[model samples]
Target: MASAPVIISAHLSIPDAELVERFVRASGAGGQNVNKVSTAVELRFDVAGSPSLPEPLRSRLLARRDRRMTGEGVLVIDAQRFRTQDRNRDDARERLAAFIQESLSVPKPRVATKPSYGAKLRRLDEKKGRAQIKRGRTTRNWE
Candidate 1:
């Protein structure tokens, strides 16, 4: 079990085995560098099979509507903004760590409640004011 390349947080970390990085030629303007060098990095993480993630967290991550996420529960991050392989690799790893750390946190469930009497009254008053404004517009002065 090799140490992970990126550390998500103090307590949680994804193993290096679960992460796969592939370098490819970056698209766009970069003189001869773009044509010859493979600076872009494609970092892939298997969210479903990673033992580091809890079951609930895995499910939540997979459930997210991210186009980068594959149907097979793999999250693919493309880092090509940088001109160097090291920078791109670092960027990819940082993004993956941020994403996983974000996924680890559970959102508080919303508590349902009826509108207050004052709020209802305020809403009705606003509606009445708008109705008055429309009535005034209809009886406008055509000079």
Candidate 2:
């Protein structure tokens, strides 16, 4: 309950109770701050067990191929791109919101189509031209 709820979309918001954030020492590019302070934020959300998410969204999030997903279905996001604790913390929450939002959108199914007759003929013509060029490169006795 440290901050406002994570807004995934206009209709969906995940409360702070559903999210867990831990501060850790960042690896690089923060000067002495990297060595002393725990600026990196590790945010965790249970995609499978959370009551906040709808079933379809939860399933879609779980089905995602991201390596961040744990075997227990927790989505862990690590944010250390900033040098400050507040910045990194916000980044982690923002990333989580964006991820959840991404799962909400369902892509339209792709409709397969055959190449046009003209396109097929053009491809064949290009292949013939290349073959003709290759044929000209052969060494002939010419005797």
Q: What is the TM-score of each candidate against the true structure?
A: 0.91, 0.88
TM-score of 2: 0.88
lDDT of each: 0.90, 0.92
lDDT of 2: 0.92
Question: Quick one: RMSD of model 2?
Answer: 1.9
Q: Estimate the overall C-alpha local distance difference test score of candidate 1.
A: 0.90
**Alpha-carbon error at 71 in model 1, in Å?**
1.1
Show where candidate 2 strays beyond 4 Å.
Answer: none
* Tens digit of per-residue lDDT, candidate 1, span 1-143: 34445788787788787799899999999999999999999999999888888899989999889999999999999999999998998899999988888888898999999999999999999999999989887855768
Q: Give the candidate number with the greatest lDDT.
A: 2
CA shift of 36, model 1, Å:
0.4
